[model samples]
Structure formats: structure tokens, C-alpha cells
Target: MKFSRRASANWKGTGADGSGSISTQTGALDKAPYSTKARFEDGKGTNPEELVGAAHAGCFTMKLSFVIAEMGFTPGNIDTKAKVTFEDGKITNIHLDLSATVDGMSEEDFQKAAKDAKENCPISVLLNTDITMDAKLV
Candidate 1:
């Protein structure tokens, strides 16, 4: 199977005052707002790091679901937060915080599945920064 996605950005004027809108192929983000202030300072819009965090969190959750099912367990629910750190114009770290509920699963097994998902998920493999996870089964 193969898949491709696209997103575009359009901006005008200088970096400090310039503003842009980002659009994605899936229409999930249609002209989402972004600006220099949004990236470097406090602004009323979204930034690249925020979007990346969202993507990572979503991807990790899906991967965990698949992993749990593969282990003969049905997941009740999984909550994940991916914190992306951007410093000095570079991405430093991605920390994944995950909590899950699954029936008839041991804490040790759940942690193993979570670790596997964090290491082998497509986005995790694609990222070049440090990745860490804090996973718990509840």
C-alpha cells in the first residue's frame, strides 16, 4: 500500500509581521493560521511544533491499539500526549506520555506493547530526535 499527503503555506510581507495560512490535502486544516509571532513568541495561532505534537500523539495511539490487538487483547481506551521540544530552531526531543486501559492485561505486558509502539511507529522511526515514553496501564 502507498499513501501521500500534502500541505501548503502562503505568506506575505516580512517575517515579523508576515502571516500565512496552511492548507492540507485532507482538508483537516484549511488555511490554518500561522505567523512568526506564533512560532517565536506568543500569538493567537498555531505553530509547527504544535502540529507535530498532534501528529505524534495520534500516531502513537493508533500504533498502541494495533499492538494490543495483536497481543490478543482488546484495548478499552488509550490516551497519549506527545510533547515536542523545539529549541534554537531545532527539534530537541519528543516525549510520549501514555495511559491505557485493557482487560486481562498485565502491567508488564502493557508497558512492553507501549514501548514497541513508540519505537516502531512510522513517525517515531522517521523522527531524528530523542524519544522517551512514560506509559502506564490503569
Candidate 2:
């Protein structure tokens, strides 16, 4: 199977003075604004790292759902947060925090599913940075 996603950005002016807007094919980000200040300073709008974190969190959560289901349990709720760290103009780490509720499942099993999701998710597989996860059954 194959799938494709697209996003576009348009910028004008210097790196420190320029501004741009980003949009995705799905319109999830319809011409969302971004700039050097937005990325490096406390400015409005979204940044690249924020977008990556969102993608990672979404992918890992979905993968965890499948992993839990395969283990013969129905998941109640899964909340995941992917924190992307950027330093020295490079992405340093991604930390995934997952909290889940599953009926009749042990904490050990839930951790296993979360770990499996972190290891097998498409975004996790594609990223080259350090990825760690803290999973809890709640």
C-alpha cells in the first residue's frame, strides 16, 4: 500500500525578517502563519517542531490502538504527547508520554503495547533522533 501527504510554504524576505504561511493538502493547516520569530521567539502561529511533535503523537497513539487490540483487549482511551527537543539547530530528542485505560489489561501489558507502538509506528521508524516513552495505565 502507498499513501502521500503534501504541505506547502511560501516565504518572503530575510531569515530574521521573513514570514511564511504553511498549508497541508488535507487543510488541517490552511495557510497557517509562521516566521523566524514564531520559531525562535515567543511569537504567534505554529512551527516545524510543533508540527512534527503532533505527527509523532498522532501516529504513536493510532499504532498503540492497534497493538492493544491485537492483544485481545479493547482500549478505553489513549492520550499521547510527543515532545520534540530542538537544540543547536538540530532535533535532539523526542519523548513520548502515553496514558491509557484498557479493560481487563495489566499494566505490564499496556506498557508492552505502548512500547510496541513507539518502536513500530511509521513516524518513529522514520525519525533518526532519540525517542523515549513513559507509559502508564490509568
Candidate 3:
């Protein structure tokens, strides 16, 4: 079986003081606030890179939970944060921070599972840039 997902974006203007629209093949459309200030700030609106980070974070967490379960451990909570850095109009680095609340898992085992998740997750495999992961078991 083969599957693919697609999204499209229409951007205008220069690096600063421009605007754009991002829409997926599913017909979900949103606006993008173009500018260093807007992107660095609260994002007066949605932006593409932010959404990519969010998607990667969520997918990573889900993958973490699944892997933990496979190892006979159930997670009480899994929190993940993804940081995407853009350089030269491309993604340069992605940092993943994850924390897990789970029983029956020692620090060593938990860290191993988290690292496996980071290394094996679909998003991590798909990204061409380097991905750094930091995980804590609490």
C-alpha cells in the first residue's frame, strides 16, 4: 500500500510585510502572517513552519507511546515539543524535547524507548535536516 499527503501554500511580497495562504488537499485553508516579527512573536496568525513543528511533535509523541506500549509499558502522559529552525529558506535543524510519565519503566529503559522513538519516527525519517532529541522520564 502506498499513501501520500499534500499541502499547498501561496505566498506573496518580500521577506517582511507580506502575506500568504496555506491550504491542504483536504480543503483546510488558513492565512500566514509574513514577517520576522510575526513569526518570532505570537504569530498574529498561523504559519507553515509552526504547523510543521506541531505535526512532528504530535506524531513523535504518538510514536513514543506506541513504542513504549510494545515494550510492555503504558505511558500516563507524553509531552513533546518540536523546534524548527529555518536557514536559507530551508529547514536547518529540528530539536525534539519529550517528557513521559509512565510506570514500570526505569530511567534507562525510558530513555532508550524515547530515543528509539525519536530515531524511528516517520517524521524524523522524512526530514532531511538533523534532528536532536532530549527526553526525560518523570
Highest lDDT among the candidates is held by which one? 2
On residues 2-119, what C-alpha lDDT tens digit does candidate 3 reach at each position?
A: 9998877677787676767666766655443344455656656676678879889988999999999999988999999999998888999889988889998999989889888888
lDDT of 2 at 106: 94
lDDT of 2 by residue, 1-138 (tens): 998989999898998999999999999899999998889889998899999999999999999999999999999999999899999998899999888899999988888888889999999999999999889899
Error of 2 at 121 (Å): 0.3
Clashes per candidate (backbone, < 3 Å): 0, 0, 0
Q: TM-score of model 3 relative to the true fold?
A: 0.80
- lDDT of model number 1: 0.92
User: Candidate 2 vs candidate 3: which has greater lDDT?
Assistant: 2
What range of 10 consecutive residues in model 3 has the weakest lDDT sum? 29-38
CA RMSD of each candidate after superposition: 1.0, 0.8, 2.6
**TM-score for each of the candidates:** 0.95, 0.97, 0.80
Name the better of 1 and 3 by TM-score: 1
The regions of model 3 sitting more than 4 angstroms off are 12-16, 25-37, 40-43
Clashes of 1: 0
